[model samples]
Target: MNTQNAEMDVESLQKRRRGCFLDAFLVGSVMFLFAAVTTLAVVGVMTVKDVESRLKPPSWTSESGPLKLTDVSSSAVFTNFAYLEATTSGLKNATMQWAVQQTSVGHNFQYDRTNHWMMPVQSGNYFMYVNLNFTCTHICPSGDFTIHVGEGVVDKLSCKVHLPKLQDSTAVIKKCWTVSSVASKQKLISHMTVPKEGLDNWSLDMGLGMFLVD
Candidate 1:
């Protein structure tokens, strides 16, 4: 009887040890699984945040690039432009000396109201334009009218107008050109030539200017 009791006690003790070992293993596995899941979630969150940050648009600043104005002010408007105006009464020797209607000195651009020239103080690109309007008081014959831009020695741009019939009417001629890498202190003067005689019979009104493009 004593031996049987001792054997039973030993069996119970072995079963308890087995149960403890299994419980310890299950707890350890659960803890390891939790740690692994937490690590994966943290990594995924960090990766998503990184991608979001990368996909976001870059902020613009004055140091980054040119300013973008929703409503541009007058001062922000083109400060490097000149617009000269003239009439036939002011034309001399077929060269029109225009008065400065609107002009601002910026981007190294200037106009000589005295010499009738658009002068640039820097060597760069410019947008030059001219507008000529002609009207005949009595009659205009079929002929060509030409506009030359530059000093009398050389021409930068030449524009021509043709009248197909003799009529007492008006004609408007406009031309624009882009000049690249103009020299500093370069002069641009304008001259008009009418194909017919009798300058007194025709009237001419003109506008011209040069604006720095870059």
Candidate 2:
């Protein structure tokens, strides 16, 4: 009877040990699965956030496009000159046009409606000239206008001019001036330096009488 009792006790103990071992294995597997799932979720969230940040503008920095320029015409008396510098990771050909703007004064110069000759194909500095006639009704103003570069408007000055004026006496006054007029016929040029990051192509579109696009 004693031996039988001892045998029964041993069997019970063995069964309990097996049950404990099985429970432990299940718990470990569940913990490992939970950890793996949590890690994957974290990684996924991070990737999504990174992509959203990249697409958001006014991007502190990134790539973008579809540049437009409008009716840019030159006058005989006051010529409008502009300089644009654009840099991009990816750039193709830039298209530009000159449009007509009805000014306070009547259009004195003949309007030549054609594609301006200064479109840039590659990455470098390009210069353009527009001859304008200035009607002395308003004082002739000349200076640099900021050219917007990139999808975001990054403004850089266009041209610098020294104007001669009549002072108090016979001596003519030579002064340096800057003007932001879209109506004058002036020389416009752009120097594009490629950016370090983002896409591969860069383009700049400067509408003579209007604003520039990049």
The prediction achieving the highest lDDT against the true structure is 1
Model 2 bad stretches (over 4 Å): 58-214
lDDT by residue (tens digit), candidate 1, 41-153: 99999998985543232232456554332211134344555555674442224777766423233445576667777777776676666666667656655566677887657
Listed per model in order, the count of residue pairs whose N, CA or C atoms clash below 3 Å is 0, 36
Candidate 2 has its poorest 10 consecutive residues by lDDT at: 168-177
Q: Over the full model, what C-alpha lDDT does candidate 1 score relative to the true structure? A: 0.62
Highest TM-score: give the candidate number: 1
TM-scores for every candidate against the unseen true structure = 0.54, 0.30
The C-alpha stretches of model 1 lying farther than 4 A from their native spots are: 1-76, 89-93, 102-107, 196-200
lDDT of each: 0.62, 0.33
